[model samples]
Target: MRFLLLILLFCFQSIQLSAQTNNYSISFDNAVHHEAVISATFKDISTDTLTLRMSRTSPGRYALHEFAKNVYNFTAFDSKGNSLKITRENPYEWKVSGHDGQVNIKYTLFANRGDGTYSQIDETHAHLNIPATFMYAPTLNERPIDVNFSIREDLGWKVATQLPHVKGNTYSAPNLYYFMDSPTELSNHKVREINIDGQTVKFALHDPGTEDEADTYFEKVKKVVIAEKEVFGALPKFDYGLYTFLACYIPNASGDGMEHRNSTILTSTRTLANGGMEGNIGTVSHEFFHSWNVERIRPKTLEPFNFEEANMSGELWFAEGFTSYYTNLILCRVGLISPEKYVEGLTGTFNYVWNSPARQFFNPIEMSYQAPFVDAATSVDPVNRENTFISYYSYGSVLGLALDLSLREKGLNLDDYMKHVWKTYGKTEKPYTIENLNQSLNQYAGEEFGHNFFNNYIHKSDMPKYNELFSSVGIVLSQDDNAAYFGAAVSITDDLNGKIQSNTKIGSPAYKAGLDKDDVITSINGKPFPNGIQFEAFVKKFKPNDMLSVTYLSDGQEKNTEVILESDPSYAISLQEKNGDKLSKKVLKERKDWLKIE
Candidate 1:
């Protein structure tokens, strides 16, 4: 009987070894006028159906994207050179059947101007954002997998991946587990490499212009990275990389970021020459912290990714919000930003959440599960779209700050909770739940911090005591009044003549003015307002309760109304350093140190 048991154990080990030996080699070589050919070969697979997926969801966006919709010219073949039948099972997944044994799949992926997929124009440049094109099987959830890629040598293209490079033009990864664990961004983006704390970190992006400007911007990023690592103990992997692709010019823009194992892809407006460093640093810090929080210690639903549909989890707040909270905190700790700057960041989040009308409609958890559908349905209407949706990023960050302070008030801090989380969920390789988080916090705070605080404040609509929390840390949250006030959040369409030809409803006083969806605001208060600046200035001149006459063109017809001016409910938060006795010097000192070198 003992001998039989030994044989079973040996068989299990052999199966594990065989699974580990499976590998994938991908080559992106055929670059025609506008399209690129991607070929992938998989070894030692016995499944009758091989499923390839174009991920609809990415790390940063917290939304579903139909990535396979972007792919074209897909085909699959068996090892014997016989054609395999391929069928589209869903928008994001494809199934290839009749695989005699091993198989090779090749497809031509279209590169569009959108941020997620493979994008290219001329030989001068190309961008390969992996989630948009790369497809994998559902069976290999946490299985070990490897990927190798060969690219055009003369294109002057440098590939950046979180996957470790085994040799020249050959990259080796631990498994399909780690492959999806990290997303790769291959582009002609600019590259910078720095060594800190015995780890080499690489930053790659398209060089927009001016060496001095680039250096100044990246130097601040370097400092933030160093500081974040110091706080987190050490980066989880031996080597790390950051890839930023400037797909287009970004001027005061907003976008999403996708986190991979060792790398992340950020889509944002082009960093301006002035203060670009600060902006880039903030972005880098947010994405980098995901290395610990979400990528490793993920919600159970996120594990064994369900590419066909949404993997819903109410804990997205912890995944994204905690990362957002730490990003600014790390910046403050590293001295890249002052304590005032850190507070200002938190205040921005606070005001954003407070001003959002959706907070009244949906709790943070409900919004987490429903955001994908809501965002997709309302993609066209900017105000109605996101205003109705809650961001774990915004609210979660605030909650993180509050939770940190609450723990501190009890003679503990986020560090203890984080350690508890890492041990209870991250170390055990388990999923996150409210119960688990509460239990962990109970252990750390020596009381039921999770149930007592999270249920009352986070899971419910109860407004958090931001003033009290910030006061505990020697920061005061202030409301800004002098900022421009538009009674309604409006989206304007410019005519060929560059005139504001149309204004769309974005849930404001304008929406309540019996204004139809596409009303062309010809004039406000008897003044011709043809542009945003004019509209903003016109709105600011009137105080709340003032009577104003308005004229608009609807469906090519003239319209008029007598409307009452009202205050814009949109709130913005500012931070001030407090030197009062509300917080003890010892508490302030501890909080400051806690943020720094965490």
Candidate 2:
């Protein structure tokens, strides 16, 4: 009898604690000026002072955004309508005292940037990324969150979000983490949904295009969803048995894609009738893959993502890069792109990782650690990233390609390996370490193969035998030995002087000759090049081991130097038939199986 009473008492107390909900209401009457009036009400306060803050970082992002910089017109009130004392505790935080058991706080948010990272409000629509639009009390993080949007019905607006709908214009989140992850979009957009395995997948597209264009785009989105589902064997069990693609392809939106627990934010400035029909689908393939890879098969370093500071992780190579490797491959598998185009498309990323000097300083693991500084981070001073960094996305994608081909050589495949990982870590929602991935590969393949791969390519930054691997599948990895390489892009000014566009590559002939960005090339080989086209044509005249006298103006001073030209260190991937190489029966079968083509 005593034990039953104790259990009942605990259950009753739990309900009471959860009932202390955080209520928020936002009205966009002043949305024409790119502003929103947001208010938060906290009830059942038990402390002498409550600390509230705007998030410095958001999920799926590594850098600090300083979201508090957009907040102004702050005020607070008690239940009796008396003003409460508020003080600035820090750049992102406010401390409120002299409040009764209940307090309401209001502020005006100036949001104009429309991307996955920030909020935007205007006469057209209100695109809200939760971290950039809302503030919360750290002490009340465990309480339920309720948000009401006074939407502009005059503009035929509708609310679309991953948040569970409570009633008209109201949404609810179980806790702060889920609330922060749910971004909402209010606009007059078109929506399409498909039911798969007892779950509904929705595509809410806010684009100014014809209905036919919207239908065509949604069909492509469906193919992407199904293709990615095949990789992981099934769709993730979404939180509410639903998943949404909240895409804003409008002129005012910035290009970005961010993955959340149950939805993804896809924003771009290209509409469906424009180049977005092809340009934006790659982001779709990349972010949907994250539904399984990073959202659930999470890195331990990013688990319980911090909102007060930057979040760093060393697993983004696999988290981001492996997904990148599959991005276009999925498109090919679904017949959206031809197999030849997919194979040829590998050339750009392959050459980028193969020829970068940054690999000498950091392996894939160390490169993953640079996310906080390079991932959407902003800085005023110039950086030497040309010599120090390679995007983990590109690096990891090529690595994933290598591993996939290597595993196929052993009568296994990456699909099975990913399924094993999904069952072990992703489905269970268990955070993983790099060692976990190593062990997963060991179990899927063998200890010897796994150890060799991680030790050489991942830990030590050694180049893979890509030529031999490509040959096994009847693909050619070839480079021109006689192509001239100047290794610096130059733009011709209206005066016909060639101007360097960016930092010169570290070991290129241009860098060796002391050429840098903003340098104007007045004369080359003792001749003044008339235009950029002519300058490029002139450089093609020299072969490797040739020398030329170059003159340029750097920082308003004329300079002269001798540059030794080298052959272009770029590789191309193509089908054996395209290169006129005979494909043996075994190689033909291997290629067919690799590309799933008949």
Candidate 3:
């Protein structure tokens, strides 16, 4: 019986090893042209022709980048270096014919944009978001990937990636899912290694910053890592064996950060060398939290990410929003942010979510779906994003904050619930639904409380009981009735104009008076408006329905109109310190445990 068990295990291992055979090689010989040359070879051709596809979108990003649009001069050749006949099936597909049992496909990718979504190459370095840089044969998407970075003799470029290294400049991935998820950088970057509770963390900065500030910057990031480790109870068993932080803090580089299985791409236009360590903390902390949330605690709708089409999901509220909520919380707990500053940040979130009219139109789950259009996706036409779409990031974070307080009152905490969910879905790479999340919350807390909380706050447009929940944490969610009022947002474009930047909200006095986004506010009540604040202050002196004569520009023509002033929106939260007696011992304890150091 023991011999049979061993034999079975050996067979399974053999099958796994034989399945990983995808090979890829990329060279930066054409980097000066803002292009990189990629060649992929696959043996054991099962057909006379192979269909290759360039991804239209990337994982972790919801927009369709149309990566194929950046590919030029694509060609395929046989093992003997014979040119193969190719057909353009569509914008995203290339049909290659006349390949021998082995095929080598090559293409030049023009990448000038720098962000989390696209590939950018130059004489200095090559920054690749995998899907934007590589094309895969359709049937081989499930196969393992082996990559070799062909070195330039004089460039002194070194590879920084989370893909497991098989040899020098050669890395291996378990499958295309993992391959496409790994972003790579090739440059003569500086390397710093730090030991964080036994984990070897590599920080690869593309441009060498001041050694002193770099150390301080990384130490702040180290604290965030430790705080999040306590939330999940343990760091994930990274497939690459260690973690990498690919930092690009150089002038002209766009600011962005993207998460992956075992590494993150941190790019910034500003460098930490010149006292920019403070700015680096918030963003790095957010992406690091994604090391657990979106990357591992998989969302069912987004699990098998569609590179060919737009990928939309309803769990971004938790995936991104909850991570955002914890971003600052973790920073504060680590002493990077003062307690007062942290509370001020929290107060800002409450004010935005509570006062913004967008919340009335879209709930968190509803806003999550808007990611397909709003999250890094571009459109050729104008959009009314300001008054319609509320970001799930802000909405979900506020909900997360409220839910945390509510759970704590019931003798449970959100950290406990998250740990439970991590054990069930995240660690296994098993994608989950909103229902799965609700059930988990119910299991941790009472079903009635969990169901009501989710339905009222997440599923519906109704907000949570913030005033009640905040008291338990020794915080006050206060509103001032006497706060001044205005119904429109005005922006100064130049000396000649202060434009009404947003189409007046429905029922707003400006909306009733027919003011729109491009209308230039030339003057107020027949006098020069001068600035937005002075105009707003002049209007604030009146009550709702009070009238004023306004002058503006429409489509390059001058006009005059009368706009009534309306009362400010009803809900706003201002965080104020509580009196000594109001903050009970129980409230103090709750606040301590909620933001306590790990």
Candidate closest to the true structure, highest lDDT: 2
| TM-score winner, 1 or 3 | 3
Model 1 lDDT per residue over 350-428, tens place? 7667666677777777767765664332366435434566677777888788888877777777865776687667655
Single out the weakest 10-residue window by summed lDDT for candidate 3: 572-581
Candidate 2 clash total? 0
Q: How well is each residue in 420-530 modelled by candidate 2, as lDDT tens digits?
A: 999999999999999999999999999999999999999989998998899999889999889888888888887888899889999999999999999999987898855
Best by TM-score: 2
lDDT of 2 at 371: 93
Measured with C-alpha atoms, the lDDT of residue 574 in candidate 1 is 38
- Per-residue accuracy of model 3 over 471-564 as CA lDDT, tens digit each: 7776666554554455677777767567887766766778778888888888877778766465566666777666778888899888888986
Candidate rank order under lDDT = 2, 3, 1
lDDT of the candidates, in the order given: 0.63, 0.92, 0.81
Between prediction 1 and prediction 2, the one with superior lDDT is 2
Model 1, residue 89: distance off in Å is: 5.8
Superposition error at 262 for model 1 (Å): 2.9
| Residue 81 displacement (Å), model 1 | 3.1
